[model samples]
Target: MQGKLYAIGTGPGASDLITVRAARLLDKLDVLYAPAGRKGGRSLALSIVQEYLGEAVQIKERHFPMTADATQKQQAWDAVAADIEQDVKQGKQVGFITLGDSMLFSTWVFLLERLSDKIDIDVIPGITSFSAIASQAQFPLCMEKQSLAVMSCTADADALRAALNSHECVVLMKVYGRFTQIRQLLEELDLLDHAILMANASMGSEICYPDLRLIESGEDLPYFSTILVNRTWALN
Candidate 1:
């Protein structure tokens, strides 16, 4: 029997937010893998779905560091992937859970790259955090002939600014720490009023506030935060 690997997205924050298909698969998975929190803490995804798992099923929590060092991140991811590979080799159907969509800014991406050659990998798409943000904020991403660009605010600020100017809609993911810097740039461009910041979208903690007028400079933000920029054309 060929073992199967699934990269599963748990959606924003709510257990019910997980897709029906993903939920079904989760119930059937023989082994589940999730990134661990600091010092053996349970992953948020695991906690959300813990009730659904059978006692017979196994859960593997892999702790990863929160660091910008490429070597550290790569090593941790590789170790996790190796562990997943070990489970698959033993003929177990493994489900790896991630917050938000598996493909969007997910640690699963690194695992996929590492294990693609050795395992039969399939990804189950879940509603991304941005989708929840848009729905909650009642945002229209883009319209006919207009383009939508989804990127990280952690990237070059100048490049992001250029994209906002060129695209009809810009969804900035990973905008947690750089909110103030990005907001300042937007303010200078007279675009702050047109943008919306979505924090902890679709979760119990979700907040959708228009304009950065209320957000403090360099305020510590959560990982679930995102910023949506509606180009002037979107005002039509």
Candidate 2:
């Protein structure tokens, strides 16, 4: 019999926020795949689900380099796919965990595209980082018919400006190294005060900045950081 593959979302840095479905799958899965930036780096996704898994479960930490090089990323994805394919072909239940929703800006997206034809796959959704941060910060994402746009901080400046001008709310993901640029744009648009910057949302070290200008210009942020801009609402 062919084994199944599960792409599970562990939620935004909070263990309790993980869905019951994802937790049950983690408990029973034979092999678990967690992503890390380096060989020995810690995986936030794995940390969320580690307590739910027992000694019988096998854990695999796969390295996914943080780079814009397409060739390097493809090579890494290929290797990970091969590893997962090997376990699946042997009829071993495999599970891959990602922070936030697996369908949203996840490494699982690439893996699924590569493995969809080779094995049966199931996806379990979890709360997204933006939603968790918004909830924790008491910031409303949208209201009535207001539209919301989510984009990466690496997006083109003009496009980002257009988005800010058009949408009532905008979420900029992966804002770690690009905070200064984003802050500049927000200030130019007179939307700086409308933005809320969050780092490690829902985690123990989570930090929220209602005033974007308060953050130092050259400060480094975590990979999990996000900036939520809501023109419809602003802090007093």
| Leading candidate by lDDT | 2
lDDT of 2 at 50: 87
lDDT string for model 2 (68-173, tens) is 9999999999999999999988998899998899898887899999999988899999899999999999999999999999998788888899999999999999
Identify the runs in model 2 with alpha carbons over 4 angstroms from their true place: 37-39
lDDT scores in order: 0.82, 0.89
In candidate 1, list every pair of residues with a backbone clash.
Answer: none
**What lDDT does candidate 1 reach at residue 51?**
64
Q: TM-score: which candidate is best?
A: 2
Worst 10 contiguous positions by lDDT, candidate 1: 227-236
**TM-score per candidate, in order?**
0.91, 0.94
